[model samples]
Target: MPTPAPSASTPPPAPPATGAAPPGLPPGPPRTPPAPPSRARRLAAPVATLAGVAAAFAYVGTVDPNEPGHYPVCPLLRFTGILCPGCGGLRSAHAFARGDLVTALGCNALAVAGYAVFAVVMAVWLVRAVRGTPSRVTVRPVWWWVLGAVLALFTIVRNLPVGSALAP
Candidate 1:
């Protein structure tokens, strides 16, 4: 027996075509990767960062942290009577800004190392920006743990009489 045809009130259903856009949505233009930033634009961040750091060092160099009432006392040292890893960071920066490496190291060896690292990283960043190449420094989780351990050790040692040399 032949099947009955649909009445005029109902139309025949159509199947969806393969790889076609959803129902009524229009196809979008071809996607393209964004263009790299201009050399000046890339350089802007590093230069601004350097400028800010320089300003901070300048301010620190001008105001002596060694004097009483210049900068706020470290709450850790004030309340807990413990020297944190950053206890003499300002003094170290001040000495570093004044080109006195020995004094900077004497104030805070760890902080002096940090300043050196910052200088090196900024130099690398500026160089890459000038060359129109992008650079990223990805530190691993292990390094962070190591850094934390080192800071803890530094704090402990600096508070000991034997580590008086490390004290501020």
Candidate 2:
């Protein structure tokens, strides 16, 4: 049997229209996008980090690391009588604060290199932060292993008589 047609009392569905609300529906409120951060707000984090680092450096600069009692000896060096990669990091920082690059390198060349890398990275971070696009330093596992290996080699060589200059 054929199906029956709709009754005359019923209304047909309206056709959809472009850029218009559907029939019987109320229009919603207009959207307002969120505002971007201000320049000072964008720079706050980087500035705080730099301030903390500067404070630490100032403390290290005032302290005399060359004095025997001023800083604790590296536990690894004390126990094994061998130089570790960080054996003279404090001295390096102290010398670096005093503007003695030669002494800082003599203390811990790797640490000095690390400081330079940190400075460059921080500079980039600050620039990006000011532009409201902060970034991160992402070292892959392989690079992390390479860094560890380099530090290990530095430690081993520094302990050897031939690499005495590397010792601190």
Candidate 3:
């Protein structure tokens, strides 16, 4: 039997071609690109980080860590009679802020290295922030393990009688 044609009152349906865009959408890219941040927004993170670092250094520079009660003793040093990796970090920062590199290294060589690393990283971050680019620091697992091992070795050596110079 022959099928009846659709009445004129009914509209024709859209074709189901795979390449065709969905109804009401433009034919090119589907999404609008996000707007970039304002200049102040881009600079905020780096500036805040630098300000916090400066405040910390200022506090450390003013405080005398060599005095017995200025800062709390390292828990590992006080309780376990062992020097931890961060045993003299405050003293290191204090000496570093005072421009005494030798004393800073003597207080904590690792902490001095950390200060250098922080400086380099923050410089990069500031540049990127000014340019409105995203930046990150990524340390792989193996490097993290190596860092831990190095800290452990430092702690052990600093606690020994022969390495008394390394102790703060």
The candidate that wins on TM-score is: 1
Residue 122's C-alpha lDDT in candidate 2? 86
Whole-model lDDT values for every prediction: 0.92, 0.87, 0.88
State the lDDT at 120 in candidate 2.
Answer: 95
Better of 1 and 3 by lDDT: 1
List residue ranges in candidate 3 displaced over 4 A.
1-31
**Per-residue lDDT for 1-168 in model 3, tens only?**
997797999888755555557789755434556799988998898889899999999999999898889888888788888888898899999999999999999889999999998899989988888888888888999999999999888888888999888888
TM-score (C-alpha) between model 2 and the true structure: 0.79
TM-score of each predicted structure versus truth? 0.81, 0.79, 0.79
Model 1 poorest ten-residue lDDT run: 14-23
Q: Largest lDDT belongs to which candidate?
A: 1
* Structure candidate 1, residue pairs in collision: none
Per-candidate total of colliding backbone pairs: 0, 0, 0
User: At residue 40, what lDDT does model 1 achieve?
Assistant: 86
